[model samples]
Target: MRFDKYNKKTRAETEKEMIGCLIVITCALVYLGYETEWGTIRL
Candidate 1:
Protein backbone atom coordinates (compact mmCIF):
# COMPACT_ATOMS: atom_id res chain seq x y z
CA MET A 1 0.00 0.00 0.00
CA ARG A 2 2.80 2.41 0.87
CA PHE A 3 4.52 1.77 -2.45
CA ASP A 4 1.36 2.50 -4.35
CA LYS A 5 1.02 5.88 -2.71
CA TYR A 6 4.59 6.78 -3.57
CA ASN A 7 4.08 5.75 -7.15
CA LYS A 8 1.02 7.91 -7.47
CA LYS A 9 2.82 10.94 -6.08
CA THR A 10 5.72 10.49 -8.45
CA ARG A 11 3.44 10.14 -11.43
CA ALA A 12 1.55 13.31 -10.53
CA GLU A 13 4.76 15.28 -10.14
CA THR A 14 6.01 14.16 -13.54
CA GLU A 15 2.72 15.09 -15.18
CA LYS A 16 2.82 18.55 -13.60
CA GLU A 17 6.31 19.15 -14.92
CA MET A 18 5.30 18.07 -18.40
CA ILE A 19 2.33 20.43 -18.38
CA GLY A 20 4.50 23.34 -17.26
CA CYS A 21 6.97 22.65 -20.03
CA LEU A 22 4.22 22.50 -22.64
CA ILE A 23 2.80 25.83 -21.52
CA VAL A 24 6.20 27.48 -21.67
CA ILE A 25 6.81 26.15 -25.18
CA THR A 26 3.38 27.26 -26.35
CA CYS A 27 3.90 30.77 -25.04
CA ALA A 28 7.28 30.99 -26.73
CA LEU A 29 5.81 30.00 -30.09
CA VAL A 30 3.04 32.59 -29.77
CA TYR A 31 5.51 35.28 -28.84
CA LEU A 32 7.72 34.48 -31.81
CA GLY A 33 4.77 34.49 -34.17
CA TYR A 34 3.90 38.07 -33.24
CA GLU A 35 7.46 39.38 -32.91
CA THR A 36 8.51 38.80 -36.52
CA GLU A 37 7.53 40.78 -39.64
CA TRP A 38 6.93 37.78 -41.83
CA GLY A 39 3.49 38.87 -42.99
CA THR A 40 4.27 42.56 -43.57
CA ILE A 41 7.20 42.10 -45.95
CA ARG A 42 6.87 41.37 -49.66
CA LEU A 43 8.92 38.92 -51.65
Candidate 2:
Protein backbone atom coordinates (compact mmCIF):
# COMPACT_ATOMS: atom_id res chain seq x y z
CA MET A 1 0.00 0.00 0.00
CA ARG A 2 1.14 3.50 -0.74
CA PHE A 3 1.79 5.75 2.28
CA ASP A 4 -0.97 8.25 1.30
CA LYS A 5 1.44 11.10 2.00
CA TYR A 6 3.70 10.01 -0.82
CA ASN A 7 2.47 9.01 -4.28
CA LYS A 8 5.66 7.03 -4.95
CA LYS A 9 8.96 6.25 -3.31
CA THR A 10 12.00 4.33 -4.52
CA ARG A 11 12.98 1.05 -2.82
CA ALA A 12 15.93 2.79 -1.19
CA GLU A 13 13.67 5.52 0.21
CA THR A 14 11.27 2.90 1.60
CA GLU A 15 14.14 1.06 3.29
CA LYS A 16 15.36 4.31 4.81
CA GLU A 17 11.89 5.05 6.18
CA MET A 18 11.70 1.61 7.80
CA ILE A 19 15.13 2.06 9.40
CA GLY A 20 14.20 5.51 10.68
CA CYS A 21 11.00 4.16 12.24
CA LEU A 22 12.87 1.41 14.03
CA ILE A 23 15.43 3.83 15.41
CA VAL A 24 12.70 6.15 16.72
CA ILE A 25 10.87 3.26 18.35
CA THR A 26 14.02 1.92 19.97
CA CYS A 27 14.90 5.31 21.42
CA ALA A 28 11.39 5.85 22.79
CA LEU A 29 11.43 2.44 24.48
CA VAL A 30 14.80 3.14 26.06
CA TYR A 31 13.63 6.52 27.33
CA LEU A 32 10.53 4.99 28.91
CA GLY A 33 12.60 2.23 30.46
CA TYR A 34 14.80 4.79 32.15
CA GLU A 35 11.85 6.96 33.27
CA THR A 36 10.24 4.01 35.00
CA GLU A 37 11.12 3.32 38.60
CA TRP A 38 11.36 -0.47 38.63
CA GLY A 39 10.94 -0.69 42.36
CA THR A 40 7.98 -3.10 42.57
CA ILE A 41 7.04 -2.07 38.98
CA ARG A 42 3.77 -0.15 38.57
CA LEU A 43 2.37 0.93 35.23
Candidate 3:
Protein backbone atom coordinates (compact mmCIF):
# COMPACT_ATOMS: atom_id res chain seq x y z
CA MET A 1 0.00 0.00 0.00
CA ARG A 2 2.80 2.39 0.88
CA PHE A 3 4.56 1.49 -2.34
CA ASP A 4 1.48 2.27 -4.33
CA LYS A 5 1.20 5.66 -2.73
CA TYR A 6 4.84 6.38 -3.45
CA ASN A 7 4.39 5.30 -7.04
CA LYS A 8 1.42 7.58 -7.47
CA LYS A 9 3.36 10.51 -6.09
CA THR A 10 6.29 9.78 -8.36
CA ARG A 11 4.04 9.59 -11.37
CA ALA A 12 2.42 12.89 -10.48
CA GLU A 13 5.79 14.55 -10.16
CA THR A 14 6.89 13.14 -13.48
CA GLU A 15 3.71 14.42 -15.10
CA LYS A 16 4.33 17.86 -13.67
CA GLU A 17 7.85 17.88 -15.00
CA MET A 18 6.63 16.78 -18.41
CA ILE A 19 4.05 19.57 -18.43
CA GLY A 20 6.68 22.10 -17.48
CA CYS A 21 8.93 20.89 -20.26
CA LEU A 22 6.09 21.16 -22.77
CA ILE A 23 5.36 24.70 -21.65
CA VAL A 24 8.99 25.65 -22.06
CA ILE A 25 9.11 24.09 -25.49
CA THR A 26 5.93 25.91 -26.54
CA CYS A 27 7.34 29.23 -25.36
CA ALA A 28 10.61 28.61 -27.14
CA LEU A 29 8.77 27.78 -30.35
CA VAL A 30 6.74 30.97 -30.07
CA TYR A 31 9.85 33.00 -29.50
CA LEU A 32 11.61 31.43 -32.42
CA GLY A 33 8.61 31.85 -34.66
CA TYR A 34 8.45 35.56 -33.84
CA GLU A 35 12.18 36.02 -34.37
CA THR A 36 12.23 34.01 -37.60
CA GLU A 37 10.64 35.05 -40.85
CA TRP A 38 8.36 32.03 -41.19
CA GLY A 39 5.75 33.19 -38.72
CA THR A 40 5.33 36.66 -40.19
CA ILE A 41 2.38 38.10 -42.05
CA ARG A 42 2.58 41.00 -44.44
CA LEU A 43 -0.31 43.18 -45.49
lDDT of 1 by residue, 1-43 (tens): 2446557567668778889999998787776664456562222
RMSD of each: 8.4, 5.9, 7.2
lDDT per residue as tens, model 2, 1-43: 7666775877789889999999998787776664446543222
Number of the top-ranking candidate, with lDDT as the measure: 2
| Candidate 2 TM-score over all chains jointly | 0.59
| lDDT per residue as tens, model 3, 1-43 | 2446557567668778889999998787776664445655322
Candidate 2, position 27, lDDT: 80
> Candidate 1: which stretches are off by over 4 Å?
1-9, 34-43
lDDT of 1 at 5: 50
Model 2 alpha-carbon miss at residue 2, Å: 8.0
Query: What overall lDDT goes with each candidate model?
Result: 0.68, 0.72, 0.68
Ranking by lDDT: 2, 3, 1
| Consecutive 10-residue window with the lowest summed lDDT within model 3 | 34-43
What lDDT is obtained when candidate 2 is compared to the true structure?
0.72
Clashing pairs in 1: none
TM-scores, each model vs. reference = 0.56, 0.59, 0.56
Worst 10 residues of 1 by lDDT: 34-43
